[model samples]
Target: MSEQRTVPETETETDTETPEVVAPEVVAPEAADAAAAGLPAPPGGSGRSRRVLAAVARWTAAVLVFGGVGAGTAAGITAMERTEVPGLATESDGRWEYPRLSLPALPQGSPRPFTDGNEGEIHHADLRALLLPAPAGAAVDPKANGGWTTRDAFLSAYGKEDRPPLARALDDSTLRHIAVRAWTMPDGTRSSVHLLRFGSVGYAEEFKDALIASEGGGVVPDILPEGAAGAKMETYGDDIDVPDTRPYIYQEPKPYGPEQIRWAYIQAGDTLAVVRQSRKGEAAHVPFQQTVTLQNQLLG
Candidate 1:
């Protein structure tokens, strides 16, 4: 009986020592928290350990919320940029359909409304809608104008068989497209603007040189009738104060009639334009004014 009681006491002591050894592991988490807080671990560090765990949870949640918000904002911006809007997106063929351009107001009133085609004439099968350039606040009346592509047709309308300068300008090597617009002035006289869009700038320059050389003394005739009289052509160099101004040729109506008319031709980029301003009374510099304004529009 004494030997059995001594064995039971030894077993009890072993069990007690085992718990003491394992007790330190339970407190290990508390000790780590104290160290992280820059404080010496206390004998009982459970409170500090709970505080550290709570702080870590809050920081992690805050990081996730902010990160998610930032990512969502970035995604929204990307979507907006990719969205298609008129004038913002290009076609598959790489053409940007620009918005209707604002033009300068006419002298009589606001510009005439836009039209699909001019009256009394037809566009070529390949001819697209006219994309005219005009100064801001000025108005354009496309319906009031008519255009023809063939050289012979153009001459027939103008009542002229041939003019050397204009014929050279119509050569296929230099000319790519020829269109004209005829608008009625406020005074009932008719005015016309010609658009000669060339295939290349080199061709345009060549056409300009030919026209300038043909009209001796830098004069452009308002009308090139076979038997015209009193044709007064004026050549302007640096004296004309205009933006992107090139050498300009102005021709007053021949015979010095009561009807006032002025004609001019100027080049902007790949287009060489002819502008004729006509009225029943005294002559005005309307053609020159339009030329300068149109050039500014082109530059823009």
Candidate 2:
């Protein structure tokens, strides 16, 4: 097991830097009316609130733009309050409401994995903090509720036949730690996220390669999840473009027993993330894609 510590809540500091404000083209008549009515204005028009929103919008755009440039760029973006942003504020598109995510504080003098002076690309923060938090209204699994878990617990996700080989591989891969989080949504969609950290980038890559390799030109992993016998490559249209990370997404073909499963493997630096979602009848693609994308962003 890896060392465990309490992850401190990130403190919000007011940005003192002044932003170069751009004038809006259209000022809604409702802005003044809304203000006079003691309600907030629509997310436009010229005012202190609009300026703040504009600044946040620009900052969010920069984060998304820089995300593809290199590793660690997305770390700063996850700290922003999602509800404060306009489009992201609501879950109207079948997206779950996840809490504001922030990278855990590193030990003094420790450089970030992709930053200068850190060649190993090792995460210096607690693994537990890297696991995505359960979304609103989710019934969290008490067994794997964002904490360090044993190797056996991690391997249990695989079929019984595949678990032995995976266990052996994990033993030889210089695996350092494993952290997990799991929850069931109101609609019966069960989701779990597992993060495996290795001693170095080479070991992590080797493990990921071994796990994903298949006999034919198949995108599915060699070892399927507990109940899934087979899966086919699934495209959510929008791909996550974070640097130093790759995602392999697949969905269990129809005629599955009971529930359909969608899973993805995210190989990021010295860590590999496995995200799995299963639902009876059918698992919606939008939420699965949204979940995987957010998790990949955090790992980026």
Clash count per candidate: 6, 0
What lDDT tens digits, residue by residue, belong to model 2 across residues 1-300? 011111223344454443344434444568878988999986665478657766677677666645544344355457666654334554345677777777789899887777777777898888888898888889999998999999998888888878877887888889999999999999999999999999987888778877777523322356668887688766554466567778888899978888999999888889999999999999988678878887887777
Alpha-carbon TM-score of each model against the true structure:
0.43, 0.67
Count: clashes, candidate 2: 0
Lowest-lDDT window of 10 residues in candidate 1?
Answer: 1-10
lDDT for each candidate structure: 0.48, 0.78
Clashing pairs in model 1? 103-138, 104-137, 104-138, 104-139, 105-137, 105-138
The positional error of residue 273 in candidate 2, measured at the CA in angstroms, is 0.5
Per-residue lDDT tens digits of candidate 1, residues 86-196?
234433421112234443333353222222332211212222234243322333456534454565545443434345446655674356677765545343555566666
Measured by lDDT, the strongest candidate is: 2
Highest-TM-score candidate:
2
Q: Which residue runs does candidate 2 get wrong by more than 4 Å?
A: 1-91, 214-221, 236-238
Residue 113 accuracy (lDDT) in model 2: 76
